[model samples]
Target: MAEVLRLHGVRKRYGGGASPVVEVLHGIDLTLAAGAFAALVGPSGSGKSTLLNLMGLLEAPSDGEIWLAGEPVHAAPDAARTALRNRYLGFVFQFHHLLPAFSAEENVLMPVLAGRGRLSADDRRRARALLERTGLAAHAHKRPVQLSGGQQQRVAIVRALMNRPRLVLADEPTGNLDTHTAQEVFALLRELNREEGTAFLIVTHDPGLAARCDGQIHLQDGRLIEPDGAGVVTAAATAPLTAQ
Candidate 1:
């Protein structure tokens, strides 16, 4: 598989100077190969979300290097970073973040609309297809308020895929759903990973969901702990489903 994302000796600090700084990431090195589905698991304030933000290009690192699709991007300009993120990265947060006024299909097209100079017929078709894939084709005409929590979240997933991003960053994507709904969403994301070969780096607190991933990176107090070979399990290993 190809390397979709890589981070080397990355470090982040909120402030600077003596008594003027707090480091969030402590020389972290990580990578995600194309078509891989991985999880980041840790306690609150472990910096998992912070790491995701940096990886997604929403925040800049205080030090170290990052490469996306083999392109060095840690020092890229704001415009370049935004362009790269728009083209190669997709994000799904805990909240659906859908516009209640827009229909499901329209919401899914939001990214496509923002990227292109203007919306076109092909964009609509792609959005429709994405909605269909998420089992939301029948609900495409409904607004977010009209759909269940699961349905709204599924729309968010398709919207994230509007650009066919090389990497998908999900921050507790299933955190807001019920046990059954969370499982369904997780299964959907995994299916898309297999079908579209989109790499995933999900930040989740649920051990069961993390166990189902290709691999899980555990973090504590802003540091990623390398799991020992003995307890590590790949995505191929069947993980027992646990209630949320």
Candidate 2:
């Protein structure tokens, strides 16, 4: 399978002031292959969100390289990076950030509209198809306020796929939902992974949820723990190093 994302010695640090620099990720080496559904499991300060932000093009790494869909991004210009981010990456968050004023279908077409200035006929068709797949077809013209939390999240998921991104970065996507709703949303994401072959790197604290993925990446204190053959997280390594 083609690699959808790769990180080479990626590191993240904040504020090089009179105070000591606070580093979040330490020379992280990671890769996500096409269609791979993986969970990023870590404690609160383990740099999971920092790593996901880097991969999703929302933040730059302190001292490493990131390649998304084969495009090197560490040194790209802002415009180029933004273009690549829009074209190759999709994102979901714990809170559904749907536009309150827009209808469900309009919310789903947001990415397409933002990228192309307008939605094409094919784009509209694809949006409806995704809505249908998510069981939101009948609510296409309803605003976000008309939908429940789970339904809003379903709309958010469809919006992420509007541009057909190769990789989706989900940060606690199911965090705000009830158990049943979370399960349904997680199942929907997995279903899309199977049907569309899009790689997903989901940051989750739920061990049960992580176990259901194809593999799990474990992190502690901003470093990835070397996984055994089964991709299960072992003990936290003391060495400040990165390994494949």
Best by TM-score: 2
TM-scores of all predicted structures: 0.91, 0.93
Per-residue lDDT tens digits for candidate 2, residues 66-159, read 8888989977877888899999988899999999989999989988877889778999999999999999999999999999999999999999
List runs of model 1 lying over 4 Å from the truth. Answer: 17-19, 227-244
The Cα error of candidate 1 at residue 221, in Å, is: 2.1
As a whole number from 0 to 100, the lDDT of residue 213 in candidate 2 is 89
lDDT of each: 0.84, 0.85
Candidate 1 clash pair list: none
